[model samples]
Target: MKPTLNEQLRQNIRFTYNEALELIVAMGMAACGEQMYAMAQDYKIEMDPMADSFYEDTKARLSPHTFRELQFFFGHNFLHKTLDFGFYVSICSNPEPQSADDWIRSLEAVPAEWMLTEMVFGVYHDKLEELLQGRDWEASKGNLSLLAALVRDTPPHQEVIHTQEPLLECLAHPEECKLRYMQLLSQFYKDVFIRWKEPLKERSEQASAHYETLFAAKPEQFIREIHKNEPEIFISFPAAFHVSQASQVGNHFLNFTTAAGNVGWVIFGIHNERVFGPAADREQTELFLKAFSDKRRLDFVLLLKERPHYGQEIASALGITPAAVNYHSNFLFFLDLISVKREDHRMYYHLNVERLRELLALTAKVMLD
Candidate 1:
């Protein structure tokens, strides 16, 4: 079928998050998932008491199965992108499947990969070398048995596959274990989801209702007004992501969609709000003043007032890196002091004169009152 994402400009947009899957995935990735770690590398969460407590408690509750083999198996691994992994898209629907059966069926249907890609890194990297050394068929029984269970029909002798990061001794029988491993993960996900189902369901319902209402009324404008810099239609519906900057976004993803006909993405974000507070209280005049007290941000804002400029252009003019420009602009963007425009791949940042005026008025009102 055609993507049809651009056709219904309004109904396709949606917001979604799988609390259970996300939590498990977070823990799994924390062990060795590169992408997950990168997103969480920033922010000194250890300094935040609540964040610290949550982290420790969650860690303590983890079982060996949940923390090790299972984590590695279910989490992203050597064959992450290569296989039709069921868990990644398991909860991508409305009124998420209410029974474990849905997951079972999904796992059973996972497409197989012909080869078990080599694992480059992990706790077990090269651990197989010792087992494979000077071993006859009978002596390799332990290794063969495990491989036999994972892969169908084993030969008299098998060779291990090498990988970039030592993640795997060989890509043998990886896809064979898809169903059994999935069954295990399925139970874990269901139990945890049920235990917290009440709160998770309630949050989901309220959020769904809120989005339905918002999208029902001028859905196109909602996308354009809030995310002018994004595409009219996302290639993937209901996308998700995580962030270490809890103070910046709280416990919510920056969610929005175009064409309400169907959801294009659900950005499941790890807001990490369990750890901290907001950037600043708008009611606090000193906070507002302090926010703009940064000379670099102030200069960036002034430049936007003249004309729209992208991060790179702004960075070039300031004799700094583009990343520096993004860092400074993010502050102004969060406070609504600026607006963004997208033309193809390039993002143009513009100063919001009206927003500045409102803040100025609010500042005056606060001072006089």
Candidate 2:
């Protein structure tokens, strides 16, 4: 018989920190300055005050031009949340780069064409040939309209840029686009690296000690309890899991990379107050009820019940925007009501039947026990 999800987690999950991962978070947040600031301010009750402070301080140090470029490259609707960048970073042979300069070199080694393809097409890059059958990607490599149309129609079930201008410009000079990205990261590093390195190192030590001890003591309990606050952190059953502490991001950020292996990386910025207590049946019941409370979320789950669907398909079926679909999907994902399958780089969502059954049973127990 297959091991239980809890057992799988205990066997596969590990806690550690990588400064390179933290730098990506920092640069991404800094690029997302206003948005990050607003989110931190709005979620201050649950966010670390240092998160906002980190963004503000780092923003003050960068020149206007460099900061704007950063936003264009990594901002949410810009390059579609920088998954292409992060994915490449995670693939570096060296698990942890010794310095910011070393990290830059690793990024430098990424092929210009591959970076451009991944940036524009996202996960579809790997499967473009298969998806298009015999059609050659090279033929349309310079056709911005065609690529944009592909992105528009074949949604990867994640946030993606809708604007065609950035991709259009990049296709004209893929190498330059890549070089400029490296340059901006370098500049961002110079301005902010010194300030961040030590704090991140110290936070890593503190978080590692606290979490590892808790996890070792009760592996099953630790895996189940860390996500007590679904609104803050979400973890699905992954082959391997990584938790990184962030300084500039909001309360929660989740990223997946298949470079070295399938790894689910969840980054949590310093939280001023967080507590993991005994599981509360009432809280679990409330979450179950709340998850189904929204009609859109319910519709999304029901849609997946018919068959696995990508983000754009779900949005089209529900008559909502892709971004809205992503929003609802996150909450469902947090509840583990949906499981993701990646085919050729695109994410497809399937309803988690077992999790659904367990939740219904748990709700019954909570309500009638």
Worst 10 residues of 2 by lDDT: 231-240
Tens digits of per-residue lDDT for model 2, 1-369: 987645555665566666666777667666666665565554333345655577788779888898778777776532234434544433333433345667677777877766666566554544466434566776766455566566545544344433345655765677788778888878877888667778767866686677666666766655554544332122342422234445432223343544554444445444412433334445656777998899988888889888999888999999999899888887877677887899778889899988888889878876786
lDDT for residue 253 in candidate 2, whole number 0-100 = 30
TM-score of each: 0.43, 0.59
In candidate 2, the residue pairs with backbone N, CA or C atoms under 3 Å apart (3 or more residues apart, or in different chains) clash, namely none
Candidate 1 on 1-369: residue-level lDDT in tens? 664444454444444444544443433433333433343453322333433433354345556665554444534441231121234333333234224345455546544331122121122223434433443433433353343333332211122222222223234444545544565565555544344445444544554555455445655544433333343544444433222211222232223333443322233222323222112223334545766888888788788889999878899887889888878776776566887899779999988899888667767755673
Q: What lDDT does the true structure give each of the candidates?
A: 0.45, 0.62
Candidate 2 TM-score to native: 0.59
How much is the lDDT of residue 220 in candidate 1? 53
Q: Compute the lDDT of residue 223 as modeled in candidate 2.
A: 52
How many clashes in each structure? Answer: 34, 0
Off by over 4 Å in 1: 1-7, 14-58, 73-86, 89-101, 114-170, 224-231, 234-265, 268-369
